[model samples]
Target chain A: MRPVRISQIYLGLLLALLLYLLPWGGFGLLVRPDFILLVLLYWLIRSPHLCNIGTAWMMGMLVDLAEGGLFGQHAIAYIVAAFLAVVYQRRVTLFNRWQQAGYVFGLLLIAQTVLLILKLFSGGELPGLAYYLSSISGILLWQLVIYSKIKVTGDKELG
Target chain B: MAQPQQPTAFFVRGPSPFARLIFFFALSIVLMAVDARLHYLTEVRQGFATMLYPLEVVASSPIRLYRYVTGYFSGQTTLMRENGQLHLQLTRESVELQQLITTQNENAHLRSLLEVRQKLHYPTKLAEITHIGRDPFVHKVDVNIGSQQGVMAGQAVVDGAGVIGQVTRVYPFSSEITMITDKSLAIPIQVERNGLRAIAFGHGRDETLYVPYLPANVDIRAGDKLITSGIDGTYPENLAIANVKHIDRDPDSPFARIVCTPAAGTDRYRQVLIITAPPAVPQIETEPPATIRKPSRHAPRQD
Candidate 1:
């Protein structure tokens, strides 16, 4: 009925961060979705004014710290992804729900690719295909949230 | 820091996404260079990690609760069986301990006879594995104790069985250990049977350590036990490290590819002992010259 509030956007991001902090090891860690990025993307779509590329960058810094890798790895990735999400945001209105899912999947992939390049630059070995499993699970989670939103609002809009 | 705002009315209220991207991207690149090359961010990282400690505890609470519940509801028979097994093991190890004591004393006596330096026993602090699998590309685990408990980076970690890893990062409340099976860690080791020394390096995956640079004709064999050589001064002498599992001596290659399984149950063991880093070794006191020497270089010619 009303537009999403900025507080709600922050609350979602906080919850996603907590999820990211959870101790998911081994197989679970391999498939654990990038929860923070998903939440940031959702808010960037729903309320670009409240959650913009800057918000995305800050979240990325937090994720990078939590992950304990080289600083700015996740920040760079999120910047690229958030920039794409905002650039095509207008076109999002024309695309259908499935196409929207595909678009978000591509964004997640780009983010992961950027992170991978940074990782390789830092003398890290090439990871196996399973390294990209997180993006797959991340998009699945995005679709799940989208489906829930449609069910709750009874609307056909991408936003 | 006044950030740029959107100059024109648009769908969004902030600066154009492109401008924001360029700004953050440049900032991040600088951060990455500083963090990866200069390594000036450890204090910053530690401060943030300490702030995140409470959230980490909260996040890990579910697993802790699961463990607690299982421990509480454990069958009495299971406990009794475990207790029985431990007692048996204790008795078995006590016999070995008696033999080891005699050997240590004899070795000390012989060293004293030879005027060799006495070996020092290192003190250890027990820590619980708070979490495992930190860097995805690296084999790392975080323990409950940190600098507050005198756990410093470069300290060797071990279990009752054998070497576990080394503390690489120390925060206020927790420390990160880079396991010997990580690509970045290497342990100086010697074969138990032959005393042949080599360095074992982590292969980055499959939980295997490989001993490289050994000539193909070296006397190493499959199933040979490897122990810490102690030359590195970090790990004490004679601690179990691994058992050689495979050795490939190809004719084309001069060196053997020796892979070994770590002796410690790193995946299952939750409790580990962190051996404090050895203090700066005392400089050996040298006898001073009766008179101050001068122009030694010119006077060194013997007729």
Candidate 2:
């Protein structure tokens, strides 16, 4: 694999943003995974120097606006998740693919949990266990990408 | 293999992770407060959203293409069968509609003879669904028509079947319709059988509407239909809103929990009509009504 370029990262983020904008409703909307956060986390874990918590925070703000929800709800959740990813960035480099998936799963759950709590605080009804299913779906998507041989970080470092 | 650059690992050069976290957390908290409490960020959000419009269209293009392709390849026999069914149904409905039109004319003439006011003809505009709401959490969507198409806030959105929702926000080329399933929306309805007026709120958990605060003894039955009462002046009178699905009278709860599925698919239809009449905005007067000592219980519902 070659070195990851800034342009590639930009393209990935832009595609993720588009996916985030697609009209979703019905059961799909309820179970829709956080696409932008998933992409941000992939980049954050793969190249911490290229994408950071600040970047995640900004994207979260965009999600907030698009969702027409209380602003900073997703921003805070994403920033917290990004901070955790950054703290363990080097360790993530040491982990093999499954371990990385596990870590990513944890990060995704943390973000969703934080969001759920914030929503409850704002008088939203308890959305039940199904609300967390999206994280599972998101992690499954991540694993699919890994198995497809689309390396998040270039494989040169692994070699 | 080439060696990695020494300074490339300068991840620690910026503020420490903890400091950055604190800074971002504080900033997000402030932003959340401003957005939630201040009502100052609507225009800012709309501007940025308008900018993101192109990307949205691009993202939705594949789905549109898939729908078109599938529709094209659909079996010809099935199409012919559906066409035949529709033609038969149309012929049957046309006879009934003609009779109803004659009755309506006779009723209007009778009302005029009695010096009664004429019923207003409601105008509606067609709008196609651009996409379902991108956020699964929010019950809203972008319609193909917008402010340029004379779409305005508070206009009722309906489908061929019945009421779907209301246009809450209008952009240049598209407008946002908050589905009746959205928690923020409430529609005034009259029970079709008895004409008892009540408000229906969207049950956030599912695609259902709830009529709360009705006494357990309220005169409503299962399978009863709810129609727009036109008390609010936003929705016109007699549009089918929902059908009473379940009426739970549990001993534990004080109010009867009446749940009804919306007559219109809350978020399912591909096309809807935006009723063109703008909602009449209530004006503030010099004195509030209570001081005049008007009876509250028998307050008249007005047009």
Candidate 3:
């Protein structure tokens, strides 16, 4: 019913990128959440008219560049996640808060699994279970966002 | 933003998500293939990395501020103790330096007598580590110096204690150092005591290195220090690397599994020196053969 300004989408993505660029190290790095993906998912659910699959691909490209990794690895992973988010965008808005969190958590896991599969194909060593710790942290961060924004106008947009 | 063409449509306003996913996936695969198999994207990657530098700076600023604050508030007693230890270290190192200078002069005279070429003295520049590698799987660090400052890829990086890593990628204002603990790095090293040469490779998952394919009865032992042999032009000879931490010579396997801990505090130190040594092989390649026999095996010194 309400219009989300186009600039707001870009600003949200930019802020997420800044968060992703934080200088994490050692154990901190192990549990760092994927900020860009969380923001992308948020926008995909709230304003699919603007932040669609292409935005995901572009953000993934930027992430790939910053990561100094295989150029398109994140692109594929993000696109896969974005596809799922966009496909279920309408249904997601009607779900209860707990179901919505589960749905978003599932999306994060899917994205990570895609990335992990690509890493394995590229001859990378199989990481331990700690590798999935990022997904858990990401879901927790997503819930934090929900809790922070739910009382305000974010309620209608979040569901 | 435009209103949905179909007023009744809730999520049917855009192109098929399946088509978008398939198209993007294919494009990404092609890009990955090009990046992994070819060198054309190197310059492109460097350009993007340079563009991303500002954000990296902004992101790391908080940690920088925290470090500065902690340093400012550090106890005076601790500072004084550290200063006293440094003074003692300087005094002891100066005595060793005096002896080293005398030996170096004598060695130069002997080299001239034998007409051997003078050893190359590499110039090194100090740099600060700005951040750890973003990817936990990759053992790398970004140092605050780059091509603009004469830092080049393939140059060896060291700390005060020992060798840490090599410069793997150079951007406009910073460079990435792939530490010796990465799977992609291998260094030619020799035992300091017996001069037994072998190659050491990084154990990918952990902060350690291993010497693979060595025989079971190899002369290597626990606590033997490994130093650069300088067979490779990338590093200077005789720099301390890792110490043999354990040797697992299983009866079932023919090769000894030698694990080592790097001498340098690669994770602990934030500053490093990048040795910008000139490439040595090209000079030797340009010269005519002095002797016909064993021409290919020619080294700076006779074996």
Candidate 4:
């Protein structure tokens, strides 16, 4: 019923980070969605004033460190995604839940695609279709969060 | 009638998103350049990662607890069977151990005769896999021990069977191991039969390695074993790396596409050893000069 504070967004980001830190291996790792970006996007769309590109960039660096990959790779991707989300924040309020879901899906893919491009430039091998599966799963997660009554700032409230 | 309204949330003054994007983008570029080119961020990354170590432990505890509980409840029969198998294996290896002792002594005597330097012994620390790579596309695993346990980057990681990977990042309480399946990984290897040397790269998707750029007529066959050659000094000599699974040579291509399945027990082993020594850094030599003697105005070279 109330606008979320900046601190709450930070707390959520930290929680997402913790999730990222959880030990996963084998098939479970192959399917692990990008939790930090998911939360960042959620907050960016819901409360742009609370979380912004800077936060997203910081989280991306953490991911780069965690994955032990090229520095700023994830940071760059997250900031780009956050920029799109912030730019579209006002318009997303006009859309229905499904439309917002589509927008979020696009954002996730954009982040992953940017990361894939950077990785390829660094001489990484082609990871194939499975690399994009995370974005789909991330969208599913966004939808679940939306349906669970955790409101994004723009979702219309019915009387 | 409503009283005069206060300014709404939208009226708040702040930097525009475009400006913020440019600022962060510029900052990230600098960071990426420094991190990629300069290697200046190691200490910074390590300190922050150490600070986040507790959160990592907290987040992983629940999953670990669940696994422990499930294993405890269902492990009785499997444990008994495993115990039986191990007893048989122990009996088999015990016989081999005697032979190994004699062979080791003979090898030592021969090496002494040849005046060869003794191989450096590496101490190892056992660490459990705390988590897999934070990003799905990257192949890495976090081990429970880190700098606190003296883990250093580039230390080879191995499970019970064979090499798994190497430590690429080390935090305070934990370290990240890039699995041999990761695309960025490359290990120097030798064919067991002919001792031919080549580098094996991670296949990026499957748990396999690819020995590309080998000539089509290369003397490698399917089922050929691959092992660490030790020339690079990152991995010890003779550790089983992989076994050749398939070889595809297209008439159009210059090199054969060789695929090999990793021999490491990534699927079965939870605990792995981290070799403590850093891989040896090779010395660099500078070229002497274009001319043997420069024409100094004041001096002439002696013939």
Put down candidate 2 lDDT per residue, B1-303, tens digits, no spaces.
333323257546788888989999999888878887897887787787788778778988988999999999999999999999999999999999999999999999999999987877889999999877755555777788888889988999999878999999877778899988878789999999999999999887778999999988788889999999987889988999999998989788778989999999776678899999878554668786776777677788765
- The sequence of per-residue lDDT tens digits that candidate 4 reaches over residues A1-159 is 465666677788888888777777656666778899999988887777667788898899888776777788899899999999989887876677777888999999999999988888776777778788778878888877777777663345422
**Model 1 DockQ (Cα-based):** 0.53
B1-303: candidate 1 lDDT, tens digit per residue: 223334233666567889999999999999999998899999999999898889889988998999999999999999999999999999999999999999999999999999998987789999999877645667889889999989888989999889988999999999999999998899989999999988999888668899989999999999999999887778988999999998999999999889999999777788999998563344665976757656477676877
Chain B only: TM-score of model 4: 0.85
Docking class of 2: medium
Cα RMSD for candidates in order: 4.0, 5.6, 5.2, 4.9
* Chain B TM-score, all predictions listed: 0.88, 0.87, 0.89, 0.85
**Runs in model 2 lying further than 4 Å from the true structure:** A145-159, B1-11, B281-303
Residue-wise C-alpha lDDT for candidate 4, range B208-270, written one tens digit per residue: 899988998899999999999998979988999999999998899889999999999765677
Taken over the whole model, the C-alpha lDDT of each candidate is: 0.85, 0.83, 0.89, 0.83
State the TM-score for model 3: 0.91
Predicted structure with the largest DockQ when compared to the true one: 3
What lDDT is obtained when candidate 3 is compared to the true structure?
A: 0.89
Alpha-carbon shift of residue A75 in model 4 (angstroms): 2.4
Residue A150 miss distance in model 3 (angstroms): 4.6
C-alpha positional error of residue A43 in candidate 3 after TM-score superposition, expressed in Å: 0.9
Q: Candidate 1, residues A14-62: lDDT per residue as tens digits?
A: 8898888887788888898888888888767655666889999999898
Instruction: Give stretches of model 4 more than 4 Å off.
Output: A153-159, B1-7, B113-121, B277-303
- The candidate maximizing lDDT is 3
Local error of candidate 2 at A31, Å? Answer: 4.0
Q: Give the TM-score of each candidate.
A: 0.91, 0.89, 0.91, 0.86
